[model samples]
Target: MTIQLKQEIDKVYEEDYLLWLEQTAEQLRQKDIENLDWEHLIDEIEDLGKAQKNAVETYLRQLLKHLLLYQYWTQEKDYCADGWAEEIDNFRNELEILLRSKTLYNYSASILEATYQKARRSAFKKTKLDIFPSECPYTLEQVLDLDYLPE
Candidate 1:
């Protein structure tokens, strides 16, 4: 690609992302290698991976938070149990759907400990409970189990 074309492509990416997307798609479909925005395309693809990783981690963290509330924090159980249960269900369902992306599923392990720690801290903040185990209480499978609930 000429310097001018490359600059234009980069400009479109910043000024009008939709146009950049359409142009990129057309370029790929037409196999116009000369005009393709290689750098931006590479960056976008890498960003997609990061986005998927972050999304999976977010789901895991949320799942852990609700599970912690449901399993421990006994004082507010009467008032919050049903709501917490519903949230646990929602987060699990979301994780199941997200896990269909193989990248997210494979990357789950890398984020598990951090996600659990964040969940523990969040639950601790709300309940002022200091009794939570130093480690995660549930395994990844247990958290994702549709039928599992802490007792």
Candidate 2:
């Protein structure tokens, strides 16, 4: 199953992998690290998590493997140009550590916000409940407004 999922991801993002690598390297070259939007990357990671939640660990391992390969490929050329190799190596090490620590499921607020926006868009397309939903089964405000029963 893990192998099959890896294959699927490889097929789906084969082009994206290269694009991300190029974009990442370019961002590094600009030395605008502080402005790099890790949130967008985290959202992609979260999307991967959603796709493979059933096999989170396996998916993360495969992702880490692919990321390391990407780093290697990107760094292999001009390996000695302005410490790029070291930076790529550091990224590879960090990816490995993240995979080993099973931290892929952890997402930042921006990631959640992006994901939620996507979900909301989908839900809106499906039904009007997205705009006006029914009342809650246990409204916290209502309960809080009521007097408590004797303990």
Candidate 3:
């Protein structure tokens, strides 16, 4: 692509992203490789992968937070156990949807420890309880299983 045309495409990406996306799709479908916004396209594709991984990490952390509450927060167990369990199921379902990709599933497993630490901190902040484990107590399988609830 000429420098002028490339600059115009990049400007469109910044000024009107939806228009740029539509135009980019048309360019790809037409196989007009010469005019394709290669730089922005590559960045967007990479961002898509990262977005999937980030979503899985987020859901896993939420699941861990609720699991800790349900399993260890004795003071409010009678009042909050069922709600926390429900949130766990919801997060599990969301994680399962995002984890359909094997890459994302493995990514979730890899980030488990780090995500759990964040969850533990969040739980402590909410309940002012320091009783939760320092490390993750549940494995990836247990967290993903719909039927599994930590006792």
Best by lDDT: 3
**Residue range 1-151, candidate 3, lDDT tens digits:** 7889888988999999999999999999999988889889999999998888888888898999999999999999999999999999999999888889898888988899999999999999999979999989999999899999888
Model 1, which residues run further than 4 Å from truth? Answer: none
lDDT of each: 0.88, 0.40, 0.92
Worst 10 residues of 1 by lDDT: 101-110
For residues 59-101, write the lDDT of model 1, one tens digit per residue.
Answer: 8998899898998878888999999999999988988988997
User: Per-residue lDDT of 14-61 in model 2, one digit per residue for the tens?
Assistant: 557776656656777998666444555577768776654434333323
Candidate 3 at 45: error in angstroms?
0.4
lDDT of 3 at 118: 98
Residue clash pairs of candidate 1: none
Off by over 4 Å in 3: none
Which candidate model has the greater lDDT, 2 or 3? Answer: 3
- Candidate 3: deviation at residue 128, Å? 0.8
Candidate 3 — worst ten consecutive residues by lDDT sum? 49-58
Candidates arranged by TM-score, highest first:
3, 1, 2
Over the full model, what C-alpha lDDT does candidate 2 score relative to the true structure? 0.40
